[model samples]
Every structure is written in C-alpha cells, then in structure tokens.
Target chain A: MKNLHVNFCGVAFKNPLVLASGVLGVTAPSLSRVIELGAGGITTKSLWREPHPGHPNPTMFGTKEYFMNAVGLSDAGLVKGVQTMKELRERTKEPIIANIVAGNIQDFGAIAEAIAELSPDAIEVNISCPNVESEFGKPFACSRIDAAAVTKLVRANVGDIPIAIKLSPNVESIVDIAKAVVDAGADAITAINTVGPGMRWNIDLRTPILSNRVGGVSGPAIFPIAVKAVYDIHAALPNTPIIATGGVNSGRDALEIMMAGGTLVGVGTAIYYHGDATWKKFTDEMSQWLEKSEFETLSDIIGIFHKA
Target chain B: MGCCGGGCGKQNGEETLHHELNTEPRAFVIDRMWEEAENIRTFVFKGTLHAKPGQFCMLWIPECDEKPFSIARDYDGEIWLTICKVGPATTRLFEMKAGDYVGIRGAYGQGFSTALTPSPSPKGRGEHSKVVLIGGGYGTAPLHFTGKCHQDAGSDVTMIIGARHKNLLIWEKESKDSGFRTLVATNDGSAGIQGFTTHILEDLLKNEAIDLVQTCGPEKMMRAIVEMCIDQGVPCEVSVERYMKCGFGICGQCVVETGEKMCQTGPVVSAEKAMTFSDFGVFHRGAEGQRKNW
Candidate 1:
C-alpha cells in the first residue's frame, strides 16, 4: 500500500490513525496490543494523580450509531501510569501519548511532571472531559481562562516534550478556546473530547440508562462536529497541529478530518464497530482512495478544504 | 479463534448480517420465566438474534443499564437468558415477568463450538463422541446450551454441575431430560458428591476417555480445570466472565490480563489461551477498569 506515515508535534507516527484514549488504552498490555494491531500511535487512558474509582456500573451505554460513556476518567493514578509507560516503552517503539486529567489545575501540572519523568512521546492535557462534571464541576475547557491556565501549567512542567491540549466542543466558541490554549504554549490541539453530557432513558421503568444519568456522546453521530471543530481551529491557527478525535469510524472520515486540517485522526468508539484491526482497515482504505485519486502523500490532502 | 471449530467464521458472517439488519435494540417479548435456583431466573424470549453456543447478548431492561448475559438457549429463534440477582440492573430484571418487554442486541463475543464433531469414542461405543462439560454456579447456564448442541450433534455429553448447595444447582433436570449424563456436586454435600466440581472433573479425567472438556464457572474453579486439562493432556475451552459495559469491545472493562478483550475476542476461550491471562483466576477489572479481587 501507500506510505501512511505522518509527523505530529515533532513525533513520528507510522500512520495518521491513532488509538484514542479510553477505548483499550487502560493498560500496557492492551496498549501494546493496539500497536501490534496497526495503530500508528496509542494514547493511554486519562491518568490521575491518585487512583480515581470513577463512576459506578452502567457507566457506559451504546446504540448502533452512538455510544455514550461517563467513565469519569478513572485511572490507576500517576504511579501506575508511569510504570505502565515504562513497561510500554520496553515492549514497543510505538509513539506513546500520555493523557493526564486532574480535578484542579495544579494537579494537572503535578501529574504531567510525574509522567514526564518517564519521557513519553507526548503529553495530552485532558482538560475537556465532559463526563466528570458531577465531581469536578464544569470542564476546564468550558472557559478560555481555565483552559489556558491548565495548558500553561502542564506546559511549564513537561519541559520541552510537546503538549496537546484536548479541547471540548461543548464550549461556547471552540475557536476562542483553541486560540487560548495555543497562546498558553500548547504544541498541539485535540479537538472534541465528546459532545454533550447526553442521556438515554427507559420509558417503561422511568429511569435513566446510565448510572450517571448523563454522559459524553461519541461514535458516528459526532463526526461532523469534530470535523468542523478541526476546521475552525485550523482556520484560526494554521500553524497549530491538530489531533481530531470524535467519531472517526472509516478512512473517509479520517480523510475528511485531515482535509479539514487534522494532523492525526483519533479513533476509539469505532473499535467497537470495526474490531481491533480498525486502524489497519482504515489505513488500507485511505491508501486505496489515495492511490485512485493519485495523491502522493497525506499532506497533499491535509487542509485541502482551506484552499477551496 | 481458539476452540470454536469453524463456528467463528459463521459467527462473523452472522454478525455482518445483524449489523445490516439494524443496530437498534430489538424488542423481545418474554415468553416464559423459570425460577431455576435461588436468586436465579431463566427468561426465554422470542427474538431474532442468531447467537452461537458461547456468544452473549446485551440484555437491555430500559433505564436499568444494559448488561452482557451469556446465551443460555437459542431454540429456533427463541432466546433464553439466565440471570442471577446480583445488582440493581439484574434485580430489576428478576422482577420482570413473562410477556414483559425487554430489548436485546448482539449475541456478541466468541462462543463455544456448536459444530464440534467430537472425536469418536475410543471404546467403540458407536459413533457418539464423549464430551465432558463442567459448570459451577450460574456458569452452568451457558454450558446447558453447549451441552444440548453437542448432544444434538450425536456427542455423548456428560454434564457435571456444582453449586454451593443442592438448591443452587441449575439445569440439572433439563440436562437429564435431554439425555445428557448428569452429575452433581455441592460444597455442603447436600446433593450427589461433597466437594467442588473440580474434584469430580479430576475423577472423570482419570477414568473416562474424554474427548473435549468445556467448563464455565467461578474463575478459581475454571482455572483449576484448565490446569487439570493441561496436566491430563486434554484440550479444553472455558467460558470467562468479566464486567462488560459496551458489549462490542468499545469499553475496556471486560479485558483480561492477556490483553484480550473478552467482549470481542471471547467470553469462551481455549484453556491454553485462558492460561495465558495472569489474572485468569486472580482478579478482574471493575466498571472503571480497576483491578478487583476475583
């Protein structure tokens, strides 16, 4: 097939397709398996400074077109997170993106500093998780000041290692938030953590589906929103790298995000629809489409919509 | 992929067909509900998900959280789900009666073989193949379906079921009625043999010329059976249970220590592959994927 390699925020990836955080990225073994399956890079599940139990059972629910989850960013804490990264580095050379989440701004820096000790490929500041609003109040990404504060703190602690500020689409103006994080020293931006703390209910029992009653909605339903988020952010800051994550299920969706200015396509929920080999299947589809279109490389299409 | 004997291919094709049909939860009318054992009820529903022996379905009780249940029976298009009253969702499910409406999707995960043409008997006991099925607790639910399938395929199936006591044992009469050689064990010796199912399995492995050993039960018991099968040089498949959120592998809650997500790769895995999981008998992750003592 065609070469699907790409470089994002100074890190080389075999393909633009990356295993998004929170699918099968909970452990080192699962992360390594995703790398073996064909993911160009893998992001660990959002790590906390201490172990967070997250929400109770019925934390997640899925329909054919959409999946909603309120896992509450539960992780084994920074100690296990560092050990997992160390073990992962020993096993595979695949790029590792350490995703850090915290209740307060200072904890974000503390966790980032702890993870930086292990020297991951990049650090992703998860300031936009919508599902934990019950425990943490509003997401940091909801306000530009809060978003920039979290990014600036993490950026100061991580040294020179690139930091990607994961942004939320639920904000009033995603472009403004993206600009704030970029101005605050974010090396890259991952748009759209999940759309809405949406809900599903059982009419018969008159009760909510998820134990949390509401969760971040993902899967095919959020693709257009993600593309628009990437497009808007890219339009505002052409120099800032973007990792577009939302509802990318197929290669066409990945190409759409790239065309809209995404440097990498983050896939998580699609693993349910396509199985573990989703990355390979998506890349193969993209290669065949590229070959037929006679595009020499991914850069030829990345941000093509901007020119149009 | 490990021990289903050509069932995986058909399952893949059926999955594609189901995907094309609709991803929405289909309405299943509960036709019957039998209180099989203490805090356990078996509900048979008229639905249209073509599930294999070891595969599972996401039983949706509307507003009460969808949980993954092993396909206990799939007679024609009627599906059976045996549930234990464990949590809020299942407690709500237990309160559900016949003619009630519930939603079901998938018949997901890898299952035990339905097409297992067991090796011919070594003692020349006709063309019937000898297959041993050991079940413990609620784990016996899925094994009943597997035993029936094997029996229908002209396999001499022996079902050894164990529970904490006689009142806890499920599907014993059903297996006996189906012409399966039924054996029972209880922890308090209120039934057939005193001790765990593994002890009976050890005796069976020694005396009986068994072809395949299939088991589903408490992780410790299953792990013990896996070790015994390995020592006896017998190929075995065990059904493993884990906390599953999204039944199609999106949620990582059901992943074992071997990095295999049980929701997709298996609920039914080979004893060899199960042995590879460091947490096989030791621990399982909870809803948030935190390691919990099994």
Candidate 2:
C-alpha cells in the first residue's frame, strides 16, 4: 500500500521530492523537464520583482563533498517567473511553488502578492541565501523577529496561498525562527538553505575560486545540518508542514530526513552529483527502502522518529 | 596516472559513461601562444586534463568572462585551446600573453566515441573504423584531436575542413602532418574545394565507405551534414554549442529543445538523436537561455 505521493498543505505531490529552489528553476520548459524526470513538484529559483544580474562568471564550483554557488540569485525577475510559472503550470498537474527573494520586507510582500495572482500551489519566501552577504548583509533568518516580520508581511499579501518560510542553517536557533515564522502566519517551513558561506583558494594560483569569493555550501556536505534543522523545526511546530532541503542525495537520505521529521524532501545539488536521474534515483531508492522496511505508505514514516 | 587512473570513477572501468565533473577553474600558466588564422589564436597551457577528444574546458580570464572552449589538443602534459576573437571573452583571451595566467576546469562533456560502425549494416569489428570528420573554422580544432585518436586506434581518418576562405581554414596542416587524409573547402573557392563542407561530404559519401561522420562548426552546416548522414544511414556524431553557465549538468541552461542537456547527454550526439531535438539545426539559446535563430 506504500506510495510516494503526499498531500502537503492541500497540494498533492506525486512524490515528496521537490526540485529545490535556485536549481534548474529558471525556465518553464526547464522546470517542466525536472517534473518529467520525476520530481514531484517544482520550486522555481528565487525571483525578485526585478531582474538580478547576480554575480559575474566563476559563480559556482563543486567537489565530491560539497557544491558551492555564489550565483547571487541571478533570476530573470518576477515577470519571467510568472510567465514561466504560467507555462509550466499549464503543462503538468504537479504542484508549483513560486520561491521569491527580496532585499527588504515590504518588497517580499509585493513580490509574493504579485505571484499570488497566478495562484501557484504555494509561495516559498526566501529569507536565507548565504551568498548575497555583500548586497543584503546577514540574512533575516539570523533573527527571529525579522523572519516573523517578513513572514507576516508575505502572509498579508499572498491572500489564501500557503506560505513556507525558507530559513538559513547558519542561525543559532532554527526552532525559534521556525516558530516565529509560523506564529507570523507561515503555513509550512522549508528548513535550511545552503550552509556556510564557504570558500576555496586555488592554492596553486593562490587565489579565490568563486568570483564572489565566498558562496553558500550545498550538496552532501550539508545534509546533516539540514536533518538537524528539520528535526528541530518539526519538533517545535509539529502541525506545520516541513520541506526538508539540503542534501538528500539518495533514498536512504530521503527517509532519514523524513524520519527526522520532514514531510516533503527536496533534491537540488544531487542533480549535479547524480546527473538528470537524481529525481528518479531518489524515488527508486526511497521506494525500495520503504518496501524493505514494510511501511504501509511513505507518509507513515513522516516524523516517525519524533513519535518515539 | 595521477588523476587519470580508474579510481576516479569518471568513465572508468567497464561502462564508458562519461559525466560532468564538479570543477573550479585552477590557474594554468600559458606555456605558449600562436596565431592560427584570421581572428583565431591558440593558447597552450602548462596543464593536463583527464579528457578525450571532443571534450571542453571552461576557460576563465580573471576579470573577463568565462566561456567553454573545445580542447584543441591534449598532449605532453599540456592542454591546448583554440579561440576566435568573436566575443568579449575571446577578445580578452586574444589580448593575453604567453607568460600570463589563465584558469581552466573540466575536460567535461560526453565526448565522441572513437569506436565507430556504420549504421544499417553494423560493420564487423574486424575491419578498421573509417571516420569522416568535417570541421567548419575553429570547429575543426577538436576534430584534429579526434583524427589523431582514430588514426592511432588503427582507423583511417579523413578531415574535411571548411571556412569562409583559405585563411580561415584551421587544422589542415596539423591533420596532414599527423598522417590523416585532409580535405578543404571554402565559400570563395580559395581552398581545396569550394561551396561548403556539405559539398565535400556529399562527394566523400559518394566515393567512399565511411564508418562514421563527426562534425562541429556552424549549426547550419552541421545540420546539413547530420541530415545527410541520417539519410545515408551512416553513423554520425556532432559537437554542439550553446549558452552554458555551468559546464556541469545541473544548470539546465544548456538543455536544448530535445530535452538534451548538451553537457551531459552530449556536446556529441548521434545524428538520429539530433534530428529528434527539433531545436537542433534551428535555434540556439542566448545568454539568458532565450531562443535565438541560428
């Protein structure tokens, strides 16, 4: 009886694996392509009311352990985001979550309101990108007050659309921030953006690798932090849906996070590590694990460890 | 075997599954630089890549832009890239000196498979593979390396190079010197044969038995060659280019209309697959991943 489908905040996903924001999230066709490859939902890359140039070339680099991107939130802006959402929404019945980012609290409201007109499955407010420190110093997720204020503002503008506040792992108390956003009217929480605005120096050249010098760390390196964050968030707000995204590269990793209290597991950097089959591979591995464990359904394991 | 050994798991051991590797552009000293033709220059870095023919490197110039360049040659623990001063990045590269430093990452892309058998009949492995490589301008750069591979593997290699004029044709001398058969064509009839690479390919197909055809150049020219090969039932592979932010497959910026993430599924695609891309031979995505006519 076990199946991968899950209903998160009234939106039914074929599986819990959502295409994480900011990865293959730009174009409608590209987003549709991810869904085609087996992602249960689409989370468009963080968009702003206006187009962002992001950073220059050498924006990203990777290794076996981690993937670093200082892509500085390069997006074609909200107009394109809406246009792409419309196109992608028409193609598939799978849920689309419009992920939006901004420099100020009010702009978050404005962007969220604009995206609400399209009536996406949900709206993910991004208050935590580690790479844009120079432009917007210290993400709002660092403080519970700012996180709540941004959440309240977005909740006010987004009409009845479900709101998931994306938080950064760099914070000292993810649970406090999660509770604050929930109290401020967020219906769900996407735990952990990229960890550590980390950097690397090409020692042979004796210089920095990324054009922005430092970028957010992602991939398998940050999976543990993601699990811990999701664990705490779900423990604090057991009723609120949680989208756990950091580095769930395999089926076991997906189940591990859900066991740690994640409702929807997000897969991003794994695409780089595992190729286009990242979604298929994650689902296959997850289904196999579930079958072996004799779980009646995938939802039966959500926050299972927290029960004990 | 520092990084080239089978342990890396990149196209290693049994399955020849080539993949995109996570890479940072590490600086390499330009050992030498030379002028090839009008607006074309070759830079040789004191660097080596775990790469094969038809693979590329993301060439970076400090304050300039980062662009992918086909590895013209990988020899003597050094990497060579050919560039034409067509854009901002290449112009910056053209301005650099021999002693200067540049950055390169990869040896990425699913490259050409030298193991070729003509389609339809599926020739026996007993006979040496005969490959016809067509290059337009600097597109011939990688095919130069490819011709060497086919020749070294005991296969017969013929390189048909095309350009707007004689001065634009590249890799002719290198191909001939490497002992592969060389053919040339130009729009103005200033080289070996006139008209286009397709004209040369037509004659070659009419006259000889080609086990495979690999081409890279202008999209339209390659399209013609691809169509011809598909029609004749000759196996073919073509190297394609598009606006790519990352050489790795994650970006999805380089996914052509056929849903082919060119960096992963190909920069080298079989002729049959190319036809299915619908977007192939038509338009390519610009920097913003927007479609623009070829």
Point to the candidate with the largest TM-score.
2
For every prediction, compared with the true complex, DockQ reads 0.36, 0.41
**Clash statistics: count for each candidate:** 1, 0
Q: List the residue pairs that clash in candidate 2.
A: none
What DockQ results for candidate 2? 0.41
Mind giving the per-residue lDDT tens digits that candidate 1 earns over A244-306?
889998999999999999998899988767776688889889888988886788767888899
Question: What ranges in model 1 sit over 4 Å off?
Answer: A56-65, A200-208, A289-301, B1-34, B44-49, B61-64, B76-78, B91-103, B118-125, B231-233
Give each model a TM-score.
0.89, 0.91
CAPRI quality level assigned to candidate 2 from its DockQ score:
acceptable
Candidate 2 local lDDT, A170-196, one digit each (tens):
988889899899999999999889998
In model 2, how large is the Cα lDDT of residue B193?
A: 72
Location of the lowest summed lDDT over 10 successive residues in candidate 1 chain A: A202-211
